[model samples]
Target: MNPGKRYLFAGLTVLLAGCTQPAADSPPSGIEAVYTDFFKEADTDRSGTLEAGEIGASIDRDFAGLDLTHDGVVTIDDIYSKEQAEPPGSTRNPDLSSHLPYDTDSDGRLTAAEHRAHLLKLIGEMDIDGDGLISFTEYRVTRRF
Candidate 1:
């Protein structure tokens, strides 16, 4: 092989190899790591992809937490109530940004169906491949609140 052609081929090979993704067994970093943790928690069946049921189950638990009043629906008052109950200088105050928009019915209340809609929207965004499955990488690009 000619010297120049050999060098070009070597460079191309290295570039293509670099483009390959890291092994799934490899530990993740930064946002990918965070999403990895969430994916593991949400992938209850260990199917590798997050399905609607898994997401629903997880979101349902979260919805229960948000509904502090136990009235079966979440309202702005409930959110603010939690925020006001926080200790002074508490950075862990409730963030309404994560809740208000989920009220799809716009009746000033958030229900389980509404909450599921928002999460399903997230999953739609995460399904970049349009395979009806959300992978950890796709989930990494999307996060509520």
Candidate 2:
């Protein structure tokens, strides 16, 4: 992917994850707090952790918005097709990405498990403090590796 597309895809991925991070100087919030907030929305069973079934249930509702062709799966081609159909000079940022969002298996097809795993991967990377917690700065500067 080109730099522009890569940047766009990264932003879309973050938006889709639905994370909330305060500024670097703001009061820190525990990873559990953020995780709870995130999982609460996706964990339909209130099981404290998200399951593939719950993730799929949520995705099923959202998939309709992305599956423009109603193929039951979204691909990069589908994204580009939507891009072309948009009006010229359109400033709209699509929720889809060519980086193959949430495709943990890298089959180029997104599954609910893949989506959940991707979020877990990102959460794993957020605890930069190494103190069993994430500082506000760590969450704000999530790119720290």
Candidate 3:
């Protein structure tokens, strides 16, 4: 190979190597390392998505914490009201936008169907190859995580 070509190849190799190195705080390399415990905890029925019954316990706790009026249900109104009520820089405030995707009907309420659909959608996005399964490389490349 020509000397110029060799130098160019070496430069490109060094740059690529630096780019591939994981950050210090990066999660371990593999879907299992990152999601095994979470999947086990959330996938109560062993189904990929967390269904209504499976989500009840965790959702109930989150709902109770966010229900400012102590109402039995959590509505979009409650989230907005809480956001407006919280002072700037308050860590107590929740990012209500995260819940919007689950309100599929846009009725301002999160139903089990919506929740399940949302989770399935996330899984679909993570399955980059459309193989119905997420690999470590797919998870790492997924920007949503």
Candidate 4:
């Protein structure tokens, strides 16, 4: 082989080898992957932490939809009513099961405070080191499985 051709082939081989290696920050499969992917998409500011405002729009929309009586609050009744009204397996219906866990006061309703607390708790879990920030490494290590 010509000297120039040999050098070009070697360069190409090196590039291919580098491409095959996994990224240092690549998230693993399962739960970690889900959180990592969500964090990446939700961190609109790219500040690494998913702040309240970053998710405020989604939260507001969901809350509004679930607060059937326009009482500025969501109760189990509202969820139950919505569930009953919707046909089985309807995609339009929101899964109310997740909200049940956030009823810390046990008043049978989910207030804004409870909603905020639930979100904060999730953020705390993701920030395993309690550094008030969730880096990719923290997210990876915090996976339950």
Candidate 5:
């Protein structure tokens, strides 16, 4: 092969090799799964946390359709008072007031380190087995509102 062709092939090979390596901060599949499930379930009121109920209630009251009986109590059937379910594609932050406050830096984005620390803390809180692992049931129970 010509010298130019040899160099070109070598560069291409290096690039292809790099594509298969695992990412530097990639989380384990199980941990990621737990994070996803717990976040979705625990953020029940969708206010972000448990405490967002008051804020959500205020917003609901302002909507015309919320008070079906006009009695000030928001029943399940009262569509106006209901908080919208979380959207499908993105992870929404739970209301901070509900349970624990998020440790977001002033800029409003979760740094990689923050994300990892949060996950570890959650695992520690939810792990009931004493084996340093969180079972699915334990995870579910801990995340319940």
Candidate 6:
């Protein structure tokens, strides 16, 4: 109710707003790093390629775990639905659900094959000039402020 208190609240609000991270739907600032991590984790055979089967089981499990309705498939909306349904203070990380926007197909589910394709497509888009690879400059420019 006091002017000084109001100004203090406003300043605190501004600082808090600036400290918040970008929404998950926004383009990530580490697209290249994401690619690297995905490649490393999913390339089970060390062959520099992501075989469909390598990620298949995990994909199936992710769908089964999130498909609370038992509909045999999971949708982007379902991820948020479950998030909201979670009990308070549960330790689940929501970052993985950020992959939704890149799901090209509207099937509301992503298979291992789809995940591989999506990552490749994302790399291509970020390449800008079709260089077939991401340079540090391109990576920084694509993901930087």
**Stretches of model 2 off by over 4 angstroms after superposition:** 1-72, 82-98, 130-136
- Cα shift from native, residue 60, model 5 (Å): 35
For residue 68, give model 2's deviation from the true position in Å: 4.5
Compute each candidate's TM-score over C-alphas: 0.61, 0.36, 0.43, 0.50, 0.29, 0.34
Candidate 1, residues 1-145, lDDT tens digits: the string is 9999999999999999999989979897887677678789989999888887887788888789889999998887788776647667856434444658767666778887888788777678878899887876677656631
lDDT of each: 0.78, 0.60, 0.60, 0.69, 0.50, 0.59
In candidate 6, position 142 carries an lDDT of 66
How big is the positional error of residue 74 in model 6, measured in Å on the Cα after superposition?
7.2
Ranked by TM-score, top first? 1, 4, 3, 2, 6, 5
Across residues 29-126, which tens digit of lDDT does each residue of candidate 4 receive? 77767766766776778887655676665456556777888887787668777765756676542434464778776767788777767766766787
Per-residue alpha-carbon lDDT of candidate 5 for residues 1-145, written as tens digits (9 for 90 to 100): 9999999999999999988846747643665566555454544555433223432343343433444556553233443225577467965444422222333553333333443455556656876766554455565568662
Best by lDDT: 1
lDDT of 6 by residue, 1-145 (tens): 8999999999999999999977756654366557555445655676654344655543455457766667655565557677657678876544434546545564557554565566556556657667454454454466553
The parts of candidate 4 lying over 4 Å away from their true place are 1-34, 49-70, 81-99
Give the range of the ten consecutive residues with the poorest summed lDDT in model 6.
Answer: 49-58
Model 1 worst lDDT window (10 residues): 90-99
Candidate 3, residue 20: lDDT = 90
lDDT of 2 by residue, 1-145 (tens): 8999999999999997787655656643576456445445766666544445665565565566666777767776666776657677875444444455566565766665565566557656766665544343454467432
Pairs that collide in candidate 5 are 47-95, 48-94, 48-95, 49-94, 49-95, 50-98, 51-98
Segments in model 3 whose C-alpha atoms lie over 4 Å from true places: 1-20, 23-74, 77-85, 88-99
Which prediction has more favorable TM-score, 3 or 6? 3
TM for candidate 5 is: 0.29
Model 3 C-alpha lDDT per residue in residues 83-122, reported as the tens digit of each score: 6565677664244446565675666665545555665677
How many clashes does each candidate structure show, in the order listed?
A: 0, 0, 0, 0, 7, 0
